[model samples]
Target: MAEPELALDPIFLLGAGRCGSTFQQVRLCETGNVWIWGEHSGVLAGLFRWGGEAANNRQLTKYVYPREPVSSAEEIETLQHDGRGMAWMNGFRRPDLMAAQRALVLELFAKRLPPGKTRWGFKEIRYGPADRVPLNLLRMFPAGRIVHTVRAPFASIESAIVAWELPTVVALVEQNDQAALDALYLKHLDRWNGITGYLLDLQERWPRKVRTSRIEHYEDERRELFAFLSLEAPTGSAGARIFSKADTAGGYPGIARAFAERRERFEARVAANAGRAGYG
Candidate 1:
């Protein structure tokens, strides 16, 4: 069966969790002609990884298909018999595999468009360079654009700990587990560094197809963002409600004391990462 074509080229909003990407998605949807969906929990990333393995299979490339067409039933029988001994006898062609992948993605993300919407896309937080998401996504949708959203590492990490009720944070607050908290903080800091580094590399490779959006500069970057997406800026604060107050009410006494003890080191790490990610 043939797959349906997408109504328009897609947009992928990529960011770490708690990076205001949800707000960016909502704001983009306010354009009335666009529909930006939420995360699918890395399903597409997994699919891409699976496809990548197949695409890179050297044995499949060498043995799956004949260099020339078979001319006789005896030759076909011989090939079939030989194929029966191999593990990947039915390996797929690259183009066919990509088509199948695109069809599945369209079914999941773009099949049922709302009446007035002409474009559709999704926001995901779980993809990083290791997943090769941007690379595979571009192969599937050559015209697609990627928006890499970012927030300050310290604020983003703090927000994620509270909002997600991370175990390390809980232990730090309740059990005074400073070592666990330190490990957790370092893990997230490494993640931020990797994601930001990947984004910068992607931008360098595909400058016209990728853009970075920072939470702190959302208001100032509004016009540029809309323009980049070829969207009309919503007029007169039509989408002004996109911004929500940051959740900063709770006090983490243990965390505070720890930060006081390690403020210089933490600040230096954040500054180094933020600078790499194009933040001031």
Candidate 2:
């Protein structure tokens, strides 16, 4: 086994959660020409959060917050246990954290990349506009590619609702009340709007570095996607389909019909922003 040749333009698969990106990740990994780690968004995200490159409500005392003296052992213990002491102990700086994160990311990929393979990357679901991973990745690999995977809005929302343990679209129909179903539809519609808005912002900001693909037309766009990734087309056992519509939300007739009924509400948004991604 020889050293895997890293790509000048590593790839990042981006999309809303439950949008069929796992299938794409598996298929692309099957090519054997690219080393792709699936669902390790947290690795980059942790570094981002530590570095103040991204923000979340989860942390009560951020490193960027005013430094408070903790002379007492009890105060020190409390701060450490409360998640604010590590940054304080480190002088509220993140250079060491940033270095450790980069080294860890590289080591993880090195362990995973097959010998003689180049062009390694990862697939992560949406991390919002403030995420530092995208820019951090670019700094690490200036020409890195960002591929946004899209799905039909209704199907995506339906899939997301179920996966996120929210009420399913099917349940709305089964409840058999028009107002209830309509309200469910509206809720999902709002969720999808946020998703598409984020994607559109990324696409616009990184027009040259970013591209979109639709899950619906993945079969047709398979070759182009591989070519874009600088991978050879996969065949034989590796190329066999690993994902099936029968296993996903779209397979259910009732759910499909429910989505269709509300198609008009989301169709215009999709057509306007997702057309390039192959969603109509």
Candidate 3:
């Protein structure tokens, strides 16, 4: 009788924007049974502005994170709201999105669930200073698996600026021919600090259920990522190779350099933490 409908296990794909949300999500869906919807960038586009953040998010992605942007704040004095949740224009959210988009997400996940495939996941760019979304997501799906899509900072940011449309910000903050040094430095500082802070925070709170992966090495890492998800191999899919492109013409050379620096710093952090966490 058309087999029983599958019960879905929701997945929340998070991390910085330029970190490979779209391609990763697309690859995850290659299993041919799960529903995939990763083409969203509203959260990052409006991190600096509060005007119509939810509306903007709705437009960019059918899946929404927070009910509003004003609610999410990492540096803004964190207030414990019984039901209120934090939002980030540049990242996922503080405290997580469970209390925010839980209902809608659960509903969608349930409706689009694949038969006999209870596990489901989504990829979203969570790059703002605040990033408790993964924690929030875990709460939502207690048995869910998180694919912490990461990449080298330089390559990641460079790819983000180009593939993900953060070039203008890069130009402004890189003191490129497009913007002044002050603007470039100010934004670059924010970008670097935001990314560094978020990644380190994740490492500190790295949940046992969470699986960390570097997208720059998607060819090698994606196999592990999908395998953990119990997803079929992404053969003939876009994830088979990196979206390699030469850094020619006008681009965020400064941001690219900063990304490289950030990666080095994080690599060290991971190494130190690895020992402490007994990750050999």
Candidate 4:
């Protein structure tokens, strides 16, 4: 009596936090065929650790039902040897078990999306170097398309400081301590560098399935981007709402000067990432 369900072709948007992914998510969802949930990588992470009784056990109901399922910590630990536990224990190596897990997860996504949507996915900012979360997603949904968003390091760092009101940047602004400023800048730079490296690696490893997009050119290239993902491209101002408000603030002129003062030092550290992000 019920209609058959549409198969979800996942479209994952990956990047560091504050790299314009939220905006991309809005645009992609505007296509009307893509149903997306925001930042649920914790669910996938639990699946990764599900079968490993050797590791700390997390209750599946905590992730699956998420409606205050009753179980003490010790009671939850006992589940590692039960049905859901066994589903992932040797499941990763067994084709049938892996398929079951994938089906279950896909069914979970289907419940969240409204009818008539042909595809589903989510945006995750949690993955970086050495993190197995993204890898696990790829394993679960091999048919998924991965879009990595990138932004200029200077803009990302400045926006982060302004948006979060980071203490490091605040201290550097008020106190002109050269050593402290350099240290804080390097910390942000290293993080951006690591994220860029991970994106490069994903692109190389999955050339056909993975693609990089610069936030700067995203508006101009929306047509091609939609084509690559097999979605109807947005036109006019239908999907052009800019979600990130960090750059609208006026303090960047002062931050730019601070960066210029240490340009030589910062440039050397981020040269590769800048090039990869198309920020020459």
Candidate 5:
């Protein structure tokens, strides 16, 4: 069978939860021919994990079939008589496996496009450097572009805790446990640091393929972002709705207090990493 041709190269919008990724998606789609889908809850990341394992396994590499099949009867006979022949766990060819993986991904993301939409992609918050998702995804779609969105860590954590209704964060706030809240901030800060560091590395490695945007500066960066993706920048504030703040219903004051108390810690961590990421 022949390999399927993808109509458009995929674009991955990656960020921690509560970042303005959805806003970015909306703006990208406003170009009229792009359809950037919502998060699938790390489904693609899970698939990439499986592919990475199979691709790197030493045993699979050693036993996998040759790229070209043996045509000669003498070669077949030699293989049949050899102590380590194709009969023992005859594995698949890596190229075939990769092609199959690409086909499956295209079926999921690109096959069903809305009318007038020729490009397709998705936004995901569950993938970070630790998951090796970016590396594996680039392997699958070398022409793919990644937009790494970021928000102030405290603001993001505060919004995520409320948006997701995290039990631990709720309990800590209810108990008014200042120390626990500080610790929590530090924990999330470490994770954010790691993700930001990885994203910076990606931008450096693939300067043309990776771009980073901060939520607070989205308005200013909007034109540049559209141009980066080769899309015509839309006029007017059609995306104002996406930038609207959610109604935290008087609950954010408490959350704000928790974050405020740990402001120094947050600043220190951001200073250590944000400068390198060009977010400072």
Candidate 6:
């Protein structure tokens, strides 16, 4: 008889595209238990490599997202009802590639996992991950953790410019325009902010199950983090290789610096109204 399959549900990392996703992933992968499939997980990988194919419809709402009402364009996305085909095309330009050419990148991480209990998961840079978790995979791993991390918006936006490498319409003659830069900045803000709202909802509803931690504060919470994962606390000797990289990162000092030197009057006004709509 064959051995029973190990469950493959994963704790999720919910954040924007260029916000040190690789850094967080490497940190987690070094833990020796997690199987980190970076960014190329599930049906989304289909869009990145191939053109499109209809997969099963499901909603995944356990990941982070904003708490506003869904718009018509958002409504039409239908990750559950329709599985969002256009989402696939948006990631990939090619449409007629063979399965071999467009195969899914299903990397099962096995650096130091114990046999018969290969605890692992996807390390994806995703915006709509919430659509996949609550609606689908959580059915299996109900205890899965969610880390909704964020970086300073300006830093993320500046990185996005390098990653996208394009001049906006307003910059037809001018290579870089302030308006386009601002627009991209706001877009990332909206995207990650939406993620924040979803995280709030998921945590509120399942406080014990879905916890909150940040890439910015990993160091202060290392031992607590391992306890949360149910792993034995590392001794001084093993600690060197385990948390060396994460320890040196420190925190968002730049963000604090920016917020510090800015106008406080406007901040007080904004904070008062931010939660006026309230949470779900």
Error of model 4, residue 12, in angstroms: 0.6
**Tens-digit lDDT track of model 3 for 21-105:** 5567766665656665563453432422332344356633433343344444553455334223223233444334333465555
In the predicted model 5, the residue pairs found to clash are none
In order, the Cα lDDT scores of the candidates are 0.74, 0.64, 0.52, 0.69, 0.75, 0.45
Per-model TM-score, in order, reads: 0.85, 0.66, 0.55, 0.74, 0.86, 0.53
lDDT of 5 by residue, 92-192 (tens): 57776687778788889996678788788999888877787877778788888899998866666656655665567768888998888778777777767
Off by more than 4 A, model 4: 1-6, 41-43, 49-104, 237-243, 252-256
Query: Per-residue lDDT for 13-43 in model 4, tens only?
Result: 8886678888888777767878776887556
lDDT of 2 by residue, 1-280 (tens): 9855545667788776666787778777666667778786456666666665423323434554345545566666567765645554534233444566666767766456676567778888755555646666655566778788877766676666555533555666677666776677677666566656676676788777776777777777777877776667665433445334433455566766666776765577556655555554
Q: Which ranges in model 1 have alpha carbons more than 4 Å from their true place?
A: 1-5, 65-91, 238-246, 259-263
The per-candidate count of clashes, in order, stands at 0, 0, 9, 0, 0, 13
Which sequence of candidate numbers ranks them by lDDT, best first? 5, 1, 4, 2, 3, 6
Q: By lDDT, is 4 or 5 better?
A: 5
lDDT of 3: 0.52
Structure candidate 1, residue pairs in collision: none
As for candidate 2, its clashing pairs are none
Candidate 1's error at 30, in angstroms?
Answer: 1.4
Q: Where does the lowest 10-residue lDDT sum fall in candidate 6?
A: 57-66
Better of 3 and 4 by TM-score: 4
